[model samples]
Target: MSRTATAVPPQGTPLRRHGRTKIRYRTRGLAWAFMAPLLIVNLLVIGGPGLASFFYSFTDWDGLGSANFVGIANYVELFTSPAVLSAIQHNLIWTGFFLVVPMSMALLGAFLLSRVRRGQILFRVLFFIPYVLATIVSSIIWRQILSPTAGIGQALQGIGIDWFADTNFLGDPALALGSVAFINNWQWWGFLLVLFLAAMQGVDPALYEAARLDGANAFREFWHITLPGIRPTLMFLMLMTVIWSFLVFDYVFILTQGGPAGSTDVIGTVLYRTAFSENRAGYASSMAMLLTVISAAIVLGYQLLRKKLKWEV
Candidate 1:
């Protein structure tokens, strides 16, 4: 005869629940403890300065002495001021150029590289070299290369090329902004290529194989398989491109100093001038606030897009 066994529930059911709750609390406490140092550093470095800037935006402080609350006066002036408007327009142009030129070049370069077998590492290293170069160093180098008197133009002129011999790139108002953008793009697109290449490598090899089996050409393979596979990285880089374009100042400041009649004046340059050069720190703070708002809006918009579209990245 077989004997039947009866099951007994766990003893001290309330005790187990309490024990689990206590463990969870302890784990959370440890996590917070581990995060405390980073939180404090971030607060001191970013949060503090950000808050001070926000406060200063509403005041008429000249970077010294007492601050008087102006109550959006600076904002009104910022919107109406022609200099500010011109700077904003330049920034928009910069954004447009970066979003189109570098992004396209990077995508094409990365796609071509992804198809190559030999010398892939060599090519990647060569392309990434420019990105590793210091901004000031590159700006100085380009400035020399573009100089009408002693630069490549003159050197080429000695070889019977007169096309660029007399062209004053940074000195001409018409070409200053575009020249700066071009220089920045030279240093930027390589980095984008590397990033896009990395993203492409993460794509499933099987997808490309399947497309090839279906008699897909190189362009078709890239369009159908590669682009979709790397959409997340592409979109992210585009978003950052917009933001960084608006914040661009280093090359412009170093190369042209927003000169040739403010042709290359960006929001960043304008802010620097208004604050330090013009000694209108309060107004500059307002400009800073505007930049902050634009950056935050872009981020928030991206977040909303991700949530609405359910992006896995």
Candidate 2:
């Protein structure tokens, strides 16, 4: 019988493996050392206030002085209060408007812009200009544009156009919220277009060519290839839209301050009024908690849906 030969171990193999492991540990330690300062800052700035807010939510802390525990009274009032309820309703309406209007406009605009080979950058810059403008500036500009007297209505009336004559876009309680949403959308949709356009650019050109060869039209290619390719960006933006719609403060604060008989009041405006205006810090903290909970629930729901649907992105 032939003797089987065994393979010999390479010299210094264990030492080499040990050296690699040591190097990996050193790299990790260096990374942590670099990250430590920022981590500490975040803990102090964000985490500290977050914990304080949680503590204050359960107490009657009026921004200063001794705290007295009031349990869930703030929360009970938050749900039952008419103002809070109206703000919630407005937030829902705002969410619905943003989810549909801007998203659709961005998708269509991006798809169209993606097909253009000339002046694309110029067009993008033009579209994105409003997004970069300060919210206060944009709000002020829109306020002038929507002014009933000596505004767009007056200018149009000069041209003998009767439409929008004596129409108060922001002043009228019936039109206030929708008008604000429209103005916000003006600054928002372009930002979405740029992002969606960037996402669309990453999709394989080969697929588009193949679809064209298969006699597919613009709508079909967009429906199938473009949408699937940009789904992750779309989903992420949609998630942010929902969150930001609830947290919206700047435009509403600047434009109407939730006025015209509380027609434009949202959760953020109400929270601001409660804490600073009314000196109800504890109640405001509870509203803050409500916002935090709602945000968390939305994120959790998205995660669950993603898992359940087996989404790849």
Candidate 3:
């Protein structure tokens, strides 16, 4: 042994590499086992339906018989139809209001509510209650409340002033759409305010204390610390609001049925009418697909905005 050249092991090397390999193999097995159910559900429920809808969108299926594939003919018809086009415009306008009005108001409300000590929980409950109600139910209630000669109308008349006497809330071409959009805001902002307040609490208390010591008041602290801390939540909400705005259907359906001379029409209701009422399933599907593209573009733009924000934390 002494006379023979001794074999040397490599420096800082293990005698066996199998330990790490075994651990990694076990970890992967566990991960896959846990993920198996979720993967199955995703494939069946989400992926399957999505693919079917994509296939359906290319055909003129009346939810019966063999579907007739029409390719880009439906798309061509979508851009050419005035009613369909007007609904797209309404959807854009609705998206604008959803982004600007309710979200801004929610942020302000959350900020103010965070400063309160007593009855804060009650305030949250009261505000968020409306969000719990179904959109269709809320729309129906508002329809009654804003009735030209029935609900709020009679009350206003007793008060010696005409409220709905001049114009119908759900029946007027000019005011119906705006009124519906406004209701959407009213029913939505409270939930958003709660969400903002919840996200705000996750921010470090020490950051606020430091700001205060530096002579930074509430406004300054919010601008520098709070905004940055809650940036992700705000971004997510903004994107969601845009989608919901364009997809609004229950409220519009219940309130105006996409009427009041079609002033309250939007992409969702337009799609419904095109598919069922007009028996233009292919064209409706095309419009729907286009709407989906627009929504995706909006989401992409918001993602770019988030990157530009450069949130470090």
Strongest candidate by lDDT: 2
Report RMSD (Å) for each prediction in the order shown: 2.7, 3.2, 4.5
Local lDDT at 91 for model 1: 94
Q: TM-score of model 2 relative to the true fold?
A: 0.93
Candidate 3 residue spans exceeding 4 A from truth: 1-22, 305-309
Off by over 4 Å in 1: 1-20
Task: Output the worst ten-in-a-row residue range by lDDT, candidate 1.
Answer: 1-10
lDDT for model 3, on a 0 to 1 scale? Answer: 0.83
- List model 2 lDDT by residue over 1-313, tens digit each: 1233225445458987898889999999999999999999999998899889998999888997888999999989999999999999999999999999999999999999999999999999999999999998999899999999878999999999979998999999999999999999999999999999999999999999999999999999999999999999999999999999999999999999999899999999999999999988998999998999999899999999999998775
Using TM-score, give the best candidate's number: 1
The residue-by-residue lDDT of candidate 3 on 1-313, one tens digit each, is 5444355544435644566677889999999999999999999997886677677778887766788887766777778989888898898899888889998899889988988999999999999999999887887788788877777877888899875566677777888888998898888999999999999989999999999999998889889998888888897888888888888898888788899778989989988987889776666767777877888898888767767977542
Provide backbone clash counts, one per model. 0, 0, 0
Angstrom error of the Cα, residue 66, model 3: value is 2.0
Candidate 1 overall lDDT versus native: 0.93
